[model samples]
Target: MNFPTKLKKLREEKKLKQQDVADKLGIARTTYASYEQGKREPDHATLVKIADFFGVSLDFLLRDENEDFQDKIFEDEAKRILKDPKTFLAARDGEITPEILDAALEIITEQLKEGRKKKSD
Candidate 1:
């Protein structure tokens, strides 16, 4: 299914109205409805919000029909990784080996600063 269809399906499966999702994405209900109706498209930032809200990956959200299964796989694996006992212990202890911690931090920083056009000092 395409983005509009998939988006509507996801929202319906979650038992949410367009306004409910719009509130979560911090956009207007009309805008969200347009997205579902395929009359308008969301930008990368909004797309990120939608994917995050639905717990799917960008690749899965934008990819063709063949890759649908990866959505659940990635979503489940991410949740598992976050809630794993080792991850919990690492958070509690404030360490998970210096290298691993640094890598994780870098990934988070990159994601949070995705639209950067220039480097900061």
Candidate 2:
């Protein structure tokens, strides 16, 4: 499943109307509907809010079920680390120290920001 599908499923599972979610998110119902329709992409901050609202990780919301799971997991994990660098920890194979992982996540976060900036430009 893709983002729109996942978002809609999550909302339905929670038994929420679009307006309820929109009110919580401080957005219009039409904007939330567009998101479920795959017509609009929320920014990074909004993505975080949505994930928090649904009690899900960013990776879960953004993951493409048909794609390679591990690859998406790592990417989403990077986003999660950005949100809480002090608490997040993960290792691919070799052991990684917390300080080193924090630094790496910072770099990834910067890259993600730059990528989004480029897209908007």
Candidate 3:
């Protein structure tokens, strides 16, 4: 896909509107819309900012035929999470509360139980 298409997809995946991205990038909504429509391209600095905001690499944003970019991006994110488990956990709800941790553990335990029951059946 082209840069504009990729940008639009990424922004949508993050549940952000054009205005949200524009505000984050400190640009106008019209400018961001132009980017999504391929009417205008952001400069190198803005490209870097966009990529950083999306937690993706510059190549992922620019390359048309780079099909493995998604895998690479996920792998990088996984490594980052593994490197700092607490930070990753905290990012889920914007803060690492004991209630959140307990809830996560409860969900995991329930899933394990369900899996075991399925296996037995």
Candidate 4:
């Protein structure tokens, strides 16, 4: 996602009102709204503040908005499934359906992101 859309999403994901972020950034509500609307961009310092406030790296917040990023998992996460009896059976045979695998992947992804966030903090 682009900066504008991502900014809006991050705010919503945090359940923060625009004014809440504005207050935190010490900026006007209108200015923050403009950033989300793509009408204005935050300067370098403000951008860094936004990144810090959201607990995300500046690169993560400013990458190409149009880039298509597919879901990725760590090699260890894949190995984890292979080592688990439930998944080992499925991997060796056809015991586990694709739905189960997908659900496992999603759960693992959430766990990994949470772990990284906590470690960063």
Best model number under lDDT: 3
- The clash count of every prediction, one per candidate, is 0, 0, 0, 0
Q: Would you estimate the TM-scores of all the predictions?
A: 0.58, 0.55, 0.63, 0.55
**lDDT digits (tens) for residues 1-121 of candidate 4:** 8889888977885678999999999999999999999999999999988975664557767885554322222232244454575654543343444544675677778889999999999
Better of 1 and 3 by lDDT: 3
- Give the top-scoring candidate (TM-score): 3
Point out where model 3 deviates above 4 Å: 66-73, 79-121
Question: For residues 9-86, what per-residue lDDT tens digits would candidate 3 score against the true structure?
Answer: 888866788998999899999999999999999999999989867756688789887465455455444544445666
Clashing pairs in 1: none
Please give the range of 10 consecutive residues that has the lowest summed lDDT in model 2: 88-97
Model 1 Cα lDDT, one tens digit per residue, 1-121: 7888888887886679999899999999999999999999999999998876775567767865854553443343344335474643543244233444454455557766874635452
Lowest-sum lDDT 10-residue window in model 3: 91-100
Q: Rate the local accuracy (lDDT) of all candidates.
A: 0.69, 0.72, 0.73, 0.70
Sort the candidates on TM-score, descending order.
3, 1, 4, 2
Summarize candidate 2's per-residue lDDT along 1-121 as a digit string, tens digits. Answer: 8999888877885678999889988899999999999999998988988886664578788877786543444455455456765445322223334544565577777989999999999
Give the residue spans of candidate 2 off by over 4 A. 66-121
Candidate 3 displacement at residue 12 in angstroms: 0.5
